[model samples]
Target: MYTIGQVAKFLGVSRDTLKFYEEKELVKPKQNIENGYRKYNRFDIYDITTVNFYREMDIEIKKIQELRKSKSIEGIKSLVDEKEQEVLKEIEYKKLILKKLQIVKEDCEKIKQFLGKYTVKEMKPLEIRGEIEHYTAYEEYETLKENTDSLKKAVTLTSLRRVIRFNDEGMLEDKFIIVRKVEDFEKDIEGEIVSHPKCMYTVIEDGRWSTGGKNTDHNVEASLRKAAIENGYKLLGLVYINLLLTTYEDGLERVFLEMYVPIK
Candidate 1:
């Protein structure tokens, strides 16, 4: 027989916890009438150990009570199976959250690297599945609002890509296309299958636009045109504007955009 204090010490539990277990009828201890003290036998100690084990597994107190009353092996197995399924679902949800966090981290890194640099590089053609809308630069936001549903569905399903056409003077024309990858594309999606051509591209990081600065996009376009001419590379096809990041500060909207102008 062990006193309440001795059992509490041995089991790494408090004396009050043992008293509560006794109150719940989880463990029965004999009372010494002569001294009015609680004395726990080996059986009570074993029962306390069982309760502690289940508690460590995060089993609820009510479920643990039910488990204590049940004696069938099959019943215990069924409970364990249910708990296993719940654990697996939690694991899957955590994995999805981790994936989203990783994507955000990568975007932050890309934004940091592309602050004020312009470069020309070869890029592979991109295949996307999303709705395409034709609108001039002046009507860009209005068109986006009109196609908000399509944009939401596409963004929810995959990554975003912007495709824009330019005129003879290297100015953005009145037509544009927005698309996302087709891997997660739904069959009922009302969008065009567009491919961004593979070629050498004049890449400009439009960090200035993020701070609500004026003419950032125009500056980038002029820079690309100047670079193309200086390097003797012929500008071809539509210019694709990829949004790297967008944030709000001091009641103003900031945008980090990248322009990919295909060149030869």
Candidate 2:
């Protein structure tokens, strides 16, 4: 027989942990009647070791208790199978997080390379769904919620500013929209899918979404008109501004937007 202190030191655990195991009735240590000291036998040590092994496998205390009383080999196998499935699910979730992290790193690089630069490039056609804005309709909100379940999926949704042209009044109007990228296999999408082709591309620093003064100073239609005349290219349809990155500078929020004005 050994003292609780001796067992704790040998097993590399705390005194409170041993006491907790005793309280859970996982181990019954002999108590000295005179000094009221807990005495642990070799059998108690073995039980502690077994309990520790189950815990390292992330088995809950209640489950460990049930396992201690479980005598059937099939019961033990079933528990191990359940734990294996849980670990597999956790691994897949971690993989999704890793992919999102890599995308964020690439976005940061884009900001460094393309901030405030103007050029014409071919924009990829996208099939997207979702609406995240203050005035989003109830139907759109329900559909967005029904489509995605994870934060990674929700944030991966492409954000855009739809600029409607008012050529008569020499003005431009814009609204922000957030939408999810619809995979090619998805056939149940309820609405029309929008697409963009060749565009006058540029990245600009601005405020969050389409608000604040940056949108006013960096006018989308006017900028595209100027760029078109300068490059001797004629502009076509409505403008699409895709949000790339958002960060803070000197206590003010800043957003990097990728503008796509289609050109003929």
Candidate 3:
């Protein structure tokens, strides 16, 4: 048997936490009446260490006590399983935090280079009246894809969107193409006005913008036109998109889009 001081020295726990654990009927240490000091045997030491291990793992105190008293392997396994899930969830949360931190660090570097910071404002209604050549040419799709990929292979997508906006006088900015947040727009709107020869066809009200994936543009344009017409308004104008923000693959990267009459 060893005194409380010895146990504290061995395990690096404060004498008080140990006493509290004892008072809570956790680890039953032996007592030496001669010196009125709490004494602990090797068995006590082992039991205390086991309890502390569970505590450090964030196991519930009541659950740990239950595990200690319950000799069933199933009970112990259940506790271990719960702790494993908690640990996995914590790891996922930490990974997300690190990803966000990396994005913030990159943004800071951009500011250092006079790359400019982003801001938001309600867009003033702009007039856009541009003609669309039909026959569904995929040239624009190919060019955007090639450019976007090039941006990724080089300085990354962040630098690419900026370069595209600067060079493509044809590029729209600060505009978000608004799409209804329904799960599926195609099946929802009956007799949707899509697949038309009319180039000037949609208008966006309050909209959210997102990164341009090849598959999304046409559907969103079609959804807006239907939504507008369903709301009793004549959908007039070339399908022009407003990029609410230029975000390169990060959450909190502002995104929204609104369709407007394309302005030449």
Candidate 4:
């Protein structure tokens, strides 16, 4: 037998914690009848050690109490198995976040290499979902809303399509279509699925006005057209802008994007 303080010191726990276990009926220490002083025996020490083990495994105190009274090995195994599954799920979730962080770091690194540089590359066929703005129906809207989870995890890229056509006023008409590049699957997805082949690729920084206070989309389009012509390539009507990052620099909101235009 040992005094409460002696047991607490040996177990690396506080005397108050030992008292708490006694109050919870987890360890029934012998009490001095005259002075009502607590005395812990070997059995009480063993119970304290077992309770500490269960608490380390994140088992609730009430559940641990029930487990102590129950002599079912299968029941205890089931509880531990549930905790194991929870840990596995947590590990997988953290792994997904780590992968996303790596991809983000890689994308940021590309700003120096690809910004303002033009090259022709063979872009793989992409499966995209979403119609051009103003042409999307109610059913299409609901479909995009329904598969929200897939949009977060499985989608490769979120992009915008701009048609390089002029309106009746001899001005460039802006028609921005929001789309998401998804995994190629045989099962049909909602909205329009688009594909592209070889493209003229470049990275562009937008959202900043020129010194003359003008939108730079026209200048970018002209530059791409010039590059295409000079390289013996033909513009295939539309530009696909894959958004990379939206950030604030020099107190101005700016967008960094990877631009792709199909070529013949």
Candidate 5:
């Protein structure tokens, strides 16, 4: 038999912790009626050791109490298995978070390099998976503008939006595509997949004017068209416009837009 303080010292726990275990009914030490002192036997030491071990494993006190009452190996194994699954899920979620952080870091670097610059580059063919809207004549701009909000909402629900231009037998169309580079050929997506052919494209970056009265997209497209024509390259498709960044100041909206036009 050992005194409460001796047992606590042997177990590397405080006497109050042992008292808490007793209060929780997880351990019952013998009482010396003459001195009104608690005494722990070998069985009591074993039970205290078990409780300490489970606590180190992060098991709930209630679960440890139930474990002690049942003394079921299968029950303990089940609890450990459930905890393992939860840990695995957390690991996967954290990995996804890290991946997203890396992607955002790269995007920030790219924007820093390309802001307010005009350049031409050869891009590989890209497959965009998302919803699209088709328009034949310029008169449909109002309807297109009206639907832009809902279209943006839908595309942004699951993925970042990259609006791409398409040419279908000389007809102009706009396709909202996922912004991320996806390597997998097969994907579960909400809309039709359109392919942007591998070609040389001129990219121009501009911003909405401080007056909030500029059509940045139209201006950028015209600039790209002029550059392509001057360089003896024919426009082969509709223009692609991507919103890079937006800021508001002094009650005015400023938006940075990138325009891409395929040439050659």
Candidate 6:
């Protein structure tokens, strides 16, 4: 048996929350006869602990009360099964956010290279992009040339096509580009993974990763792998080099890629 204060101390919850829980009929504390104070027995402590754990797991208070009302193993199992997908999805989102943060930190380290002269600005909703399709890994270089040739022959893209940085949501499994047009969906796209530019990426400070394209002149994958290892995290997944900006230079079209890794 314990008093309200004692129970709160034992369970590491604020007395106010426990009182609120009682007021909500979530927990019914035993009554004290002499002064009509609240007394929490061992059952109350167990209930509070369970509630705290569920709350930490982001379970809704109303749902917890419903479970308490049903108080059946089958009902509890069914509720848990329904919640499993949501929990997993949230975890995946958190992992991607963390990875993005790490990538941003790395980019900030080499401020001049990544930012150039650009100042900070809020990102608006990404505009629609056009894309070419059916490019193979080996012919990725020639495919880019072909796409450029087509771009020249057709109406020049009035709106510059920029590759938008995308947070992985378990659907982006293939390496592809976001272009100004999608001419061939089945053949030209989803064929080339190595044709695009690659770079070595690493997190420097503030848990963000940035790719330095210095290794572009040499072995691309090896340099990127070295950078990943140097950053104190393993290469758990594929790195996405997003072509955020593009321009033509010296008979070569250069695209600035935002190198990214998904982390958990």
lDDT of 1 at 146: 50
The C-alpha stretches of model 1 lying farther than 4 A from their native spots are 14-39, 120-216, 227-264
Give the candidate number with the greatest TM-score. 2
Candidate 4: how large is its RMSD? 5.5
lDDT of 2 by residue, 22-67 (tens): 8998999999899989988889999999999989999788888898
- State the lDDT of candidate 5 residue by residue for 45-121, as single tens digits: 99999999988877889889889878577888998887788778778777866875785566566567766555665
**What TM-score goes with each of the models?**
0.58, 0.79, 0.45, 0.67, 0.58, 0.44
Off by over 4 Å in 2: 132-142, 152-178, 182-194, 208-218
lDDT per residue, candidate 1, 38-120, as tens digits?
99899999999998987887777787889888858888788788888988877877786687678668767766775555566
Tens digits of per-residue lDDT for model 4 on 18-49? Answer: 88888889999989899999888899999999
Q: How well does candidate 5 score on lDDT at residue 135?
A: 31
Error of 1 at 33 (Å): 10
Candidate 6 residue lDDT tens string, 1-264: 788888878778888999989987888998878998998878888888888887886778999988777758888777777788888877877785686568556644544354322122212222233343333344444544444423223422222332323222322344454333334333444332322222333322111122333334124444544555565444444554433444455545554444444332
Query: Where is the poorest 10-residue window by lDDT in model 1?
Result: 149-158
**Against the unseen true structure, what C-alpha lDDT does each candidate score?**
0.65, 0.71, 0.49, 0.71, 0.62, 0.52
Clashing pairs in 4: none
Task: Give one clash count per candidate, in the order shown.
Answer: 1, 0, 22, 0, 0, 20
lDDT of 5: 0.62
| Per-residue lDDT of model 3, residues 18-100, tens digit only | 99889877899877779878878888999899989989989888887887777578778887898899899789777856865
Better of 1 and 4 by lDDT: 4
Off by over 4 Å in 4: 1-39, 60-66, 69-71, 129-145, 148-193, 207-215
Candidate order, lDDT descending: 2, 4, 1, 5, 6, 3
